[model samples]
Every structure is written in C-alpha cells, then in structure tokens.
Target: MKILLTGITGQIGWELQRTLMTVGEVIPVRRNEMDLTQPNSISGTIQQVKPDLIVNPAAYTAVDKAESEPELAMAINGIAPGIMAESAKKVGAALIHYSTDYVFDGANTTPYTESDKPNPQNIYGKTKLVGEQAIASSGVPHLILRTSWVYGLRGKNFLLTMQKLAQEREEIKVVADQIGAPTWSRVIAETTAQILSQARHHVSDFLVSKGGLYHLTASGQTSWYTFAQAIFAHDVQHSERKLQNLIAITSKEYPTAAKRPAYSLLISQKLSNTFGLFLPDWQKTLELVLSE
Candidate 1:
C-alpha cells in the first residue's frame, strides 16, 4: 500500500516515519514540498502522490502566536485539511488527520468524548475544530484523532522547555489549574500504525467502517505543575538541573494571548473499543521518552 505522510519533520511525523514503514510504502512530505499554508500545494501534492492513504499531521500549532496571525493559522489549520480531503476523494484515498483537545471549552469535569459538542475557546482551537469538521463533511473516508499535551524529545514542546528552564533558572512556575494528559508523540504514531495495520480488508474499506472523530491520548491526566514535577523527577540529565523550586500557579498568573481550557482531558475509550488499543499512562510514557 502507498501512504503519503505529511509533516515528516514534526515530532509525531518523525516518529511516524519509523513506525509506519512496516505498514506501507511511506512517502514523507516536508513543509516546503507540501506547505499546508498553500491550498494549491496541498491539492497539487495529493493529486501527484495519489496514495491509498494520506496521513496529515501538519498544522500551524503556535497557540499564542495564532492569536496574532489568525489568517495564517486558519489557512493552514482550517482550510488545508478540507482541500486535502477533497483531493483525497478525487484519488479514492482515505485520510488520517490529527486534531487537538482544545476543540472543547474545557468546561466539563468529566473527560471529553467524540460526540461532545465543541466550543473552542481560542483561535487555535477554533481553527483545529474547523479542520476536523471539514474532513468529516467532505465525504472522504477519514479518522480525526484528537489528542492533548503532546510532547516528545525533538520539537519545541513542554518537556524540552521545562528541561531547558531547569538548566537556566533556579525556579520554574507552571500552570497548576489547567489539566490534561501529556502524550508522547511516539505513542500517537505507533497507535496510528497499529490502526492501519489492523485493517482486515482494503484500507479504504477499513476507514469507512471505523473512521470518524476519536480521542487518542495518554491514559491519565495531570496539571502542568504536576507534569513538570514528574519531568524533573524522570529527567535523564538530573545532574545538570539548576531548578530548586517548581512553583504551581493559576492560569491568571501567567497570562497568554490565547485563552486555554482549564480542563481538557479527552477520554480515549472510543478508540480502545473500536481498535482495542490503549496508550500508556502519562507518567509511564514520560519515563519511556526520557529514557530514550
């Protein structure tokens, strides 16, 4: 099977390159080759590749910066996926797209499900929700996997930021109120591979039966403050740590351009029920990532 994978340079995409090789003939597309910001580039690339499966992990992910550049963010995150889906439909291909938990308002105490009505609180979340909707409405066989607090060894994420701050600063203040699961990128990629590999018949047929919106994230939930503490505890370079104090603060303590959800924990039971797959707890995934 031919699989066209976008965002090859991203953390999840990088891991996907390793995990998806066994599933199909992977065609990795970098940003320059298939920029999500350009609609023609998106449709053009899909038309050219014409793969059986199009896995898109690329998006304009700067949450705060997206407030300032809503147009660019919307162009990439909102408009591109629809074009990709339309193009995929033209070529008889299925799509696997990644979304975020921010699609919800974080107003609920319980974990979010696939059927939950999304009320995005910020521009980034709003755009991602638009992307998910576009794919769903485009009549393309697709899977919209919503995840939260994604971090990996490579890329600018919470884990690397904490490690860098630990080395430079004596004290670190993380948001204590906001809650979500800290999912490793490799887990997302590996799970995607598993989903595709589990295809009993044709790839498109598999997606037709199982494709829809599903939450895929690490098993457990924690606040940013607790997650930072866990990171410090399991950090491989513990000896180089200069962090003496890890302070817990409210969302108001450190204001941002975007309004983040206070509680955005997504329930992955649908994914588990459909695919019989489950991700490790956040703590265990963190340990595995740090060890690697």
Candidate 2:
C-alpha cells in the first residue's frame, strides 16, 4: 500500500510523515516536485507515483491575500483537487483530502453537521467548497475531512503568531467573537493514520461504504482571544518573554480582507460513529503540544 502524501513540508504533512510510515510506503511531494496550480502537473505526478492512496493537505492558505489572487486560489484549491481525484480514480486509489470549516457563513448558532448547507462568505471558502463538490461529484472513494481552527508548532498559524507576539510585545489583542475548535496538526495526522489502518485492513468496500464527508476536529470549541490567552499562560509566563496581558476584541474591530465565520464549530460525531475515534479538547491539545 503505497501512499502519495502532498504538502509534506506543511505542519500536518510533517507529522503525517512520521505517523503514515506505520501504514505503508509514504511518498512526500513538495511544491517544486508537483505544482498544484498546474492541472497537468498533478495528473502526471499521480500517474507516475501510482499510489494506492492520495492524501492532499496543500492549498493556497493565504486567507486575506486570496481575495486579491482569486485565479491562483481557484486553481490550487478548486481545480487541483478535482484533477487529483480524477487521477486517483484512474489508478483505483482512494483520496483523503483536508478541507476547512470556512465553507459556511457564520449564521448557524449550533455546531455544523455534514448535512448543513454551505454558504461561503469569502473567495477562499467558495473555492474550497468548489473543490469539495467536485471530488464528491467525481464518485471516487474519498474521505473529505472538514476541520477548523488548525494550528501547529511549525506553521503560520494563530498559536505561532501569538507566541511570537507575546515574546516581542508586552500585550496583544485577539478577536473573541470567532468560535471554533483549535485542532493540533499532530492530532489530525495521527487520526488519519488510524482511519487508514482500519480501511486497509478491510476490503475496498470499507472505503466505498464510509467514503463520504466527515467532521474531524477537536472536541470542544473556543474563541481566538481565549485560545491565545491559554497559550500565553501555559509557556510565556515561564519563559523570559514576560507577556503582560491579552485584550479581547470583537471581529469588527480587527477586520481582514477575507470574511471569517463567527461560529464555525463542527461536530465530529460523524467521524466518531464511523471510525470510533475522537480528539481531545482544544485547550488540552494546546497544552499537550506545548508540553512536547
């Protein structure tokens, strides 16, 4: 069982390299190796690799900048997955793709389920939704894992940004209105390995039966301000950084070019029901990541 893993340099992909080795031979594809913007490049690389499974975690992740580079975002986030799915299908392989919670507008007061209607508010979200729809329409055996508020030690994420700010500045302000789970990238990788283990043990029917969309995220939800405060309180206080305070502000006060969901909490019951797996709370994962 050879696995073609994209975005190996990314936070999740970095951890996946360690975890997926237990499952099968893992092939990491860096950007220069296979550019996602080039549709021909994707198909050529997948055909050459001929992996039994294709796991894509790469994307045009610049949320605010995506508004300016709509075409680039569409090519990477929208069209590229479709090409990969087509390639995977031709090789009789399954595709495990990661998606974002931003697919929905911040309107629902409750946690979003797989059945919820997606009404993306930003170009980034719209393009991601396009990719999701295209993969499902292609009728390939796939696992569309929709996660939210992802962070890791080695990436451009909220936790790293807050840690840098706490070290340099005495105090920092963060948006509190936004609510979602802050999932650690390591947890996502570990869980994916578990899912793949079970799928591999079973026949192809296992993936075909369970190969729809599912929410994979931390158990609990939180706001950006609280999440930042926890990160600071955990390690910053002990270090010489000496961070003073964290100010909680509304989303309107701290605006961005790309509109974000105020409440994009995703319920992971579907993932648990199918795979019998669940992640720790957002706060707990933060502490665990900091501890290591």
Candidate 3:
C-alpha cells in the first residue's frame, strides 16, 4: 500500500518513517512540496501522490506563539487536514490524523472520552478541534487519534526542556496544577503502525466500525512538576544535581499567552477495546525514551 505521510521531519513523523516502512511505501512529503499554509498546495500535492492512505502528523504546534499567529496555526492544523481528507475521499483513500486533548476545556476531573464536547481554551486546541470536525464531515474514512502532552528525545518538548533546565539551571520552576498524560512519540507511532497493519484486512470495514475518533494516550496522569521530577530522577546525571531546588508553582505564577487545561487526561478504553492496543504508563514510556 502507498502511504503518504506528512511531517516526516517531526519527532512522531520521524519515528513513523521507521515503524511504517515495513507495512508499505511511506512517502514523506517535503515542506516546500506541500506547504499547509498555502491551502491549494495541500490538495494539489495529495492529488499528485494519489496515496492509498494519507497519514497527517503535521501541524502548527507552537502553543504560546499560536496566540500571536492564529491564522498560520488555523491554516496548518485546522485547514490542512480537511483538504487532505477531501482529496483522499476523491481518490477512495483513507486518512489517519492526530489531534490533542486540548480540544476539551480540561475542566473535568475524570478522563475525557471521544464523545466529550471540545471546548478549546486556546487557539491551538481550537484549530485542532476544527480539523477533527472537518475530517469527520468530509465523508472520508478517517481515524482521529487524540493524544496529550506529547514528548520525545528529539523534539522541543517538556522532557528535553526539563532535562536542559535541570542540567543548566540551579532551580527550575514548573506548573504544578495542570495535569495530563505525557505520551511518548515512539509509542504513538508504534500504536499507529499496529492499528494500520491490522486494518489491512478490510480498510473500509475498519473505518465503518472503528473510525471517527479515539483517545490514545499514556495510561496514567501527572502534573508538570511531578513529570519534571520523574525526568530528572530517570536520568542519573540530572538526578544527581541539586534537583531539591526544583520548585513547584501555580499556572498563574508562570503566565503564558495560551490558557491550558487544568486537567485533560484521556480514557483509552475505547481504543483498547477496538484495536486491542493500549500504551504503557507515562513514566514507563519516559524511561524508554531516556534510555536512549
């Protein structure tokens, strides 16, 4: 099967290239070839590739910067996936898109389900939710995998941020109130590969029975402060440092342009039951990434 994969340079995309290679032809589109900001470029490129499956992991992911650059974010995260879906439908292809838990307000104390209403507190979430809606309405077979607090060894994420700060700074202050699962990029990619390989039997049947949306995340939850502590503790060099100086502060103390969810943990029961796949705990996944 020919699979057109976007965001090949990203952490998830990079891992996907490795995991999805054995399954089929994984074509990683070049940025210049398919600039999401240029709307026409999306459909035009999809038409040219004419892939059997379109897996889009590309998105304008700058949370804080998105406040100042809503248009660009909306175009890439909000508009691009819809165009890809429409094009995929035209060619009788399937789509697999990734979303975030930020789609919800994070007001709930429990895990959010696929049926939960999306009330994005910030522009990033709003745009991602828009993409989800667009793909669902496009009448194309699609799977929208919603994840949270994604991090990896390569990308600019909380794990690397905390590691760098721990090694460089004497003290690091992190938001202690905000809570969510920290999903590792490799886990997401691997799970995606597993689902795709299994769906090969009857792609249309899989879409009809198990498409739409699913919450795929690490099994457990924790705060930023605790997550940082875990990261420091996981790495011997960083752990030996005066991590005692690590301070826990409220979200109000460390203000940002975007308003984050206080709690956006997602339930994976649906995904587990549907695909027989469930990711390991956040801490376990973190250990795997750090081991590298």
TM-score of each: 0.98, 0.97, 0.97
Tens-digit lDDT string for candidate 3 (3-78): 9999988878888999998778889997998998887898888888888898999988999999999999999999
Candidate 2, residue 80: the lDDT equals 97
Cα RMSD (angstroms) for every candidate in the order listed:
0.9, 1.2, 1.4
For lDDT, candidate 1 versus 3, the one ahead is: 1
The TM-score that candidate 2 achieves is 0.97
Cα misplacement distance, residue 214 of candidate 1 (Å): 0.6
Residues forming the 10-long window of minimal summed lDDT in candidate 2: 198-207
lDDT for model 1 comes to: 0.93
Task: Tell me model 3's lDDT, rounded to 2 decimals.
Answer: 0.89
For candidate 1, the 10 contiguous residues with the lowest summed lDDT are 198-207
Candidate whose TM-score is highest:
1
Clashing residue pairs, backbone N/CA/C < 3 A, model 1: none
How high is the CA lDDT of each candidate model? 0.93, 0.89, 0.89
